[model samples]
Every structure is written in C-alpha cells, then in structure tokens.
Target: MRILVVEDEEAIAEGLKFNFEQEGYEVVVATDGHEALAAVSQTDAEEFALIVLDLMLPGLSGYEVLRELRQKQVMTPVLVLSARTLSEDKILAFDLGGDQYMTKPFALREILSRVKSLIHRHQSIRLSTPAAPADPAPAAEQSSSTQGSSPGRFQFGRVIVNFQTFQVSVGERVHSLTTLELELLKYFIEHQGEVLSRTRILNHVWDEHAEVTTRTIDNFVLRLRKLIEPDPSKPVHILSVRGTGYRFLPFPSSQDVTDEEFAE
Candidate 1:
C-alpha cells in the first residue's frame, strides 16, 4: 500500500515516512499543502491508499486542501493530524470529509495502527462494492441486503446507500461518503433496531486499539443523521436511548420512535 504524509515539520514527516516504510508501505512525504495536492493529482496511475495530513501547512491550508480534494471527488481516505484540539476544529475536519483526526504529540504506535486500519478498511470497502448498477435495486431487495450481491446496498427511509461507490442517495441529493461514515452506516444496518452502546460501537467499528472516546461515535452518528434523516432534528430511523446508545429502524413507524428517544 502507498501512503502520503503531508506535514511541514521535516523531522516529524521523515519520522513517519521511515516508520511506514519499515512496515512495508511505500511512503511519500509532502511538506506543504501545495505539494500534497500536486502529489495527489500526479499520482492518478498509482493512487495512494491513505493520507496523513497536518492542518498547519505552508502552502494552502489543510482545510483548503481537503475541501479541494473532496470537491474534485478525490475519495482517498485522510487522517488529519493537527495540534488543534477544539471540538469545532475536529468537526470541521469531519465536515471536510476526513476519515479520522488525531491530535499532535500523538503516540507513534497509535498513528501506525490508525494508518493500518484506514488502508485495510478502505480496501475492504472498495472490494466489497460492485460496479454501479444499471438499474436501482428492486424494492424488496432494497430494504434488506441485495438478494445475492456481495456487500449489497442498504436502504432506509428515502436513502439508498451504494457501498461499492461509497455514495448515499437521500431523496434527490447524493453524498460521497468517507471511509468512517461508510463503515458506521454499514454497522448500523447490520444490527438494525438494536440499542448499541457508544463503547461497543467504537470498539467494533473502529478497532479496540483506537485511543478515542465514545464522544467520537456520537459525532459520527450526528453526521450520519444529517445524511439519512429527512429531518436531522427529529430523527426517525436512528434513535437515542435516553442514557444508553442508539437504535436504527430501517422502516420506522409511529411506535418505533417515542418523543423521549430521538437523537439530540
């Protein structure tokens, strides 16, 4: 697998490259956002499996680079490594389609683990997805798994998720999903209607080695709501269980959601 590490600090950038190379990955280092973009654009024939980006950069800011990548439909998974620890900063990264965000002064082991997971998961998702279908799946197959497809599509409400292309169709709007978003949505679908605790969701969706909090799961759930729910403020498919976790109802009815259990 190949990885692109975009960081202005030469020491940190070289350190990451060495470690990743030792792990048998082809690593490329970009010291600024402009270089990062150039490397990405020029590598069409040999696509990168993952990107580790630093928000603080000399050329275009990390945010600008990320925005441009997503705008251009570059779906390479990005792992944002920044010193900024504010909740808004993390949210902004996710909003810009980052798969994961880690604070600076992080453990090297954790970074390695995250990189491994990101590449592995991305490959799995891509392999599972079929080429775009000629016709929309039949209704009966839509609610459940596509009768005999590998990692078939899943539907709830007016939303249709094409796992192969990582696209979610909600009513008339279509959104390209990040790796994290795709996996979480799949997890929810596989265990629909069950109240899943934040910890369990985290450990299962993200590996147990991930040093992240349950709050991360909540942020992702909030993101998913904006995509799948007709009204995010009043969710019907994804419900919050008072003090527990969340429940996904593929075909929600009046009895499936009570006033007391909708997500915040």
Candidate 2:
C-alpha cells in the first residue's frame, strides 16, 4: 500500500518515510501543506491508503489541508500527528474529518500499529459496501418510499441515517458523518440499552495502541448528541450513567414508542 507523509520537519519526514518503506509500503513525502495538497491532487485520491499529517507547516496549516481534502470529497484515511497536545486541537482535528490524532513525541511503533489498523478498517468498510448494479434501472421504476429506508439505515427522532452513504438527515438539514462518528453510532445501535464503559468504547472504536484519552470519547459523544439529540444539553438517546459511562436507548420515550423504531 502507498502512504503519504506530510510534515515540515525534514528529519521527521525522512524518518517516517524510511520506517514506512521498511514496512513494505510505498512512501511519498510532502514537506508542507501546499506540497501535500499538490501530491494528493496529482494522484488518484485512493492511490494513498493513508496520510500521516502534521499540524504546523510553512505554506498552509494541516487543518486547512484536511478541510480542503474533505471539501473535495477525498475520503482517504488521515492520521494527524502534531505537537499541539491541547484537547481543543485534537477535537478540532476529529471534527474536521481526521481519522486519528497523535500528539508528538509519539512512539513510531504505536504509529505503525495505528496505520495498519486504520488501513485494515478502511479496506473492510470498502469491501463490505455493495457495488452498484451492472444494469441501470429506469428512474420511473425506482421506489421513493424505500429510498433511504434500507437495512443499512437507522431512523430515530428527527434523524435519518444511511450507513451505506454516511449521509445523515436531521430535520431539514443533511450532514455527512465522519467515519468515527458513524462507527460509534453503529456500535451504540448494535448494543442498545447496554451501558458501555469508556474502556470498552475505546477498545471497540480505536486500536489498542491508539493514544486517545477517555475524555476524547466524551467529546465524540457530545458531537453525536448535537447531531441526533433534539437538545444536546439534555440528551435522551445517549444517556449518561452518572459515574459509569453511557447507555444507548435506541427507543427513547420522548419519541412515540413503536415496535419498528430501531434499525432493522
């Protein structure tokens, strides 16, 4: 697999390139955000299985590069490495569609582990997606009633989620959910009404060597609430269990109770 290493530090970039090359991956180095953008644009977005990005750069910030990539619908997995260890910085990175974040002075072994895990997960997701039909069906024959209500869809409250497309419709606004958010939500849906601890959540959602704090999970849950809850401050679907972690109540009482409420 090919990997892109975007870092302004020449020594760090060279080191990463060498290490990734040693692991049998074609490594491409981009010294700055501008170079990174150029490299990504010049090649097929899927040509690189993963991108290792640094926050500080000479031409443009890593945040900007990430934003532009997502804006262009480039869905390649990105693992952000930065010296900025602040929680806010990490939160911003994830919110901006980063697949993973690592604070600097990080171990190379851990990064390698995360890279392998992310690539595996990404490939699995891609493989599981059903391909389009070889013969096209006429638009007139298509059914609108079951358009977004497939088996891969989940609807609750004012939210309609199509897991296949990662498209979420909340009320009148439609939003594209990040991979982590979608995975977290899928996990919650699969284990509805069960209280999940932070450790379990981390084990399930992130790699074993992923350098993320429990508080980061809380932030992600908060973001999920903002997307699904009518009022994020007073969430009903993803309820907090006091000293414990969280409980996923797929059929919250606030909405009209029905046997066919949760995802089928």
Candidate 3:
C-alpha cells in the first residue's frame, strides 16, 4: 500500500515515513499544504491510498488543501493530525471532508492503527457497492466479507448508508468514516425517529463498562451533525431533544418539516 504523510514538522514527517516504509508501505512526504496537494495530484493519479495531514502549515493550511482536493473530487481518505483537540475544531475538519482526526503528542502505534483501519474500511465500502454491468459478480462477491451485517440501504434525509459495507454518502461526496463513526451512525439508523439520550447512546455505542466522559459523545454528535444536518447550527435531521439528548428523524417528508424549520 502507498501512503502520503503531510506535516510541517520535519522530525515528525521523517519518523512517520520511516515507520510506514518499515511496514512495507511506499511512503511519500510533504512539508506543507501546497506540497501535499501537489504530491497527491502528481502521484500515480488516485493511487495514494491514505493521507496523514497536519492542520497547521506554512503556505496553505491543511484545511484549505483538504477542501480544495474534495472540491476537485479527489476521494483519497484523509486522517487529520492537529494540536487542536477541541470539539469545534474537529467538527470543522469533518465538515470539510476529513475521515478522522487525532490530537498531537499521539503515539505512532495509534496513528498506524488508524491509518490501516481507515484504508481497510474504505476498500471494503468500495467493494460492497453494486458494480457496473461490465464487471463480474464473482470478483465483487469475493471482495466483501459476509459477516454480521444487514441488507437494505439506511435512509435519513438525503443520506443513504450500507451497513454491511459501512459506506455513507451525503450530497455527492462519499466519506470514508472511521470504525467508531460507522458504529455510531449505525446505531442512529437502527433507532431513527426516536429520541435517544446521551446516557443511552453511551451505554450502547461505547460498550457498557466504558468510563468515557460525556464530552466524547458530544464530539461524536457534533461530527455527525456536520454530516447529516442541512444546517448543522439549526439542525433538521438529527434534532436536539432539548435539555435531554437527540433524535434521528429519518426520511422525514416535506409535510413533517417547514421550508425553513427542522422536521418534527
């Protein structure tokens, strides 16, 4: 597998490249956002399987580069690495089409795991989609694992999800989400139209004995809001339960919502 490492810090970039190369991956390094964009465009077309992007950069910011790439329809999966661990910052990155975000001072092993998981998940999603008439069924069948999964697409206000593949598409850009995001989205899809409290979501999604704080849930919800909400600030699909929690209003009709208001 080939990967792109985009970071302004020289030591970090070199260390990552060395580690990835040792893992049998063809590694490419870029010092800033402009160089990162050029490296992606110039590399074997769409061959760079993953990108490790740092938020702060010299010439162009990582956010700008990511937005530009998505605007140009480059579907390469990106894992953002930033010193900013705030919820709002993470939300903005996701809104701009990032697949995952990690804070600075992070362990190299964790980064490697995330990179591998993202690439594997993306490959699975692409393979699970229905192929064109020219393609053979046997090859497609061989690509996906028929494990614990369900059929039928998950629908909620212009969003469609394939549970088996863990694929989600909003507007036209298909995002390759991390494992945690996929699980959370699946839970919402399963219980659409019902208000689910943070406590309940925590127990179900993060395992029963999880000691994780509520802020984690909030961050995850913020990221989800960026994806499914038409106007995330004034949500429509995923509605706030008001001093309580949240509700996933699935496939709400025009009658359920006003032209300017969120659905009932």
Best by TM-score: 1
User: Candidate 3: which stretches are off by over 4 Å?
Assistant: 43-46, 84-88, 125-184, 193-195, 199-237, 251-264
| Candidate 1, poorest ten consecutive residues by summed lDDT | 129-138
* TM-score quality measure for candidate 2: 0.77
In angstroms, give how far residue 103 of model 1 lies from its true place.
2.9
Note the Cα lDDT for every prediction shown. 0.81, 0.78, 0.70
Off by over 4 Å in 1: 127-151, 209-211
Tens-digit per-residue lDDT, 92-193, candidate 3: 776676777788888887888878877776665444423111212245443233312334345443566664545567768575444456667767756776
Clashing pairs in 1: 129-164
Q: Return the clash pairs for model 3, or none.
A: none
lDDT of 1 by residue, 82-182 (tens): 99998888888887888888998999999899898888898787656432323233665453343223455655446788877788888789888888889
Give residue 248's lDDT in candidate 1 (0 to 100).
78
User: Residue 87 in model 1: shift from native, Å?
Assistant: 4.1
Reference-based lDDT, residue 177, model 2: 66
What's the count of clashing pairs in each model shown? Answer: 1, 0, 0
